[model samples]
Target: MAETKKTSATPTKVAKKEKMLRVTLVKSPIGYCKDQRQTAVALGLNKLNSSNELPDNSAVRGMIFKIKHLVRVEEI
Candidate 1:
């Protein structure tokens, strides 16, 4: 027979935390590829020097990578 382990009812200290990314539109997307422009816009960067705080996830990272030449990314 297998033995069962006892468990405590105490709450765990584990907490869910979301990382944030500080993205800024450092350069203009004009004359660039259409996809790059779209990506920049989707990231909430519509003007030069404009910044947006977004979740640090794969989707956001992908968008940033697509327009790396037109913007800058920093972790917060």
Candidate 2:
């Protein structure tokens, strides 16, 4: 006589990852509108050549877009 073994089936899933963006204040916002200046401060860039690593999300993208002329962005 022979013995048999049983096995179970399982499914595999892919892992998700979080992305980050580098935001830098390349130009001064001194002459820009109050709203633009506020946006820079909101992004934690109060001085020239300052930078912040922020999550790559809609909210952060929106802020960067607002100050595109006054700042630079990079992917990390």
Candidate 3:
């Protein structure tokens, strides 16, 4: 047998948050490996002193690691 129950309730708000990583190009990527230069561009850094706020995730972290010498990373 199947039975049905009635209930009235309000859903509470749930906030989901993800940490952010601040990446900035501090040095020139010229003379570096092409792949490393590309990684820096892919991270939204096209020029020295350029900065981008990216998600603090593995993918972004990997990109940063690839161009670590050309950029600086901070957690926000």
Residue-by-residue lDDT tens digits, candidate 1, 1-76: 9999988889778878889999999999999889888898899998899999999989999899888888888999
lDDT of each: 0.91, 0.93, 0.90
lDDT: worst 10-residue window of model 1:
8-17
Top-down lDDT ranking: 2, 1, 3
The TM-score, computed over Cα atoms with residue i paired to residue i, of candidate 3 is 0.82
Best by lDDT: 2
* Global CA lDDT computed for model 1: 0.91
Please identify which of the two predictions, 1 or 2, would achieve the higher TM-score against the true structure: 1
lDDT of 2: 0.93
Q: Write model 2 residue lDDT over 1-76, tens digit each, in one string.
A: 8988865576565787789999999999998899999999999999999999999999999999999999999999
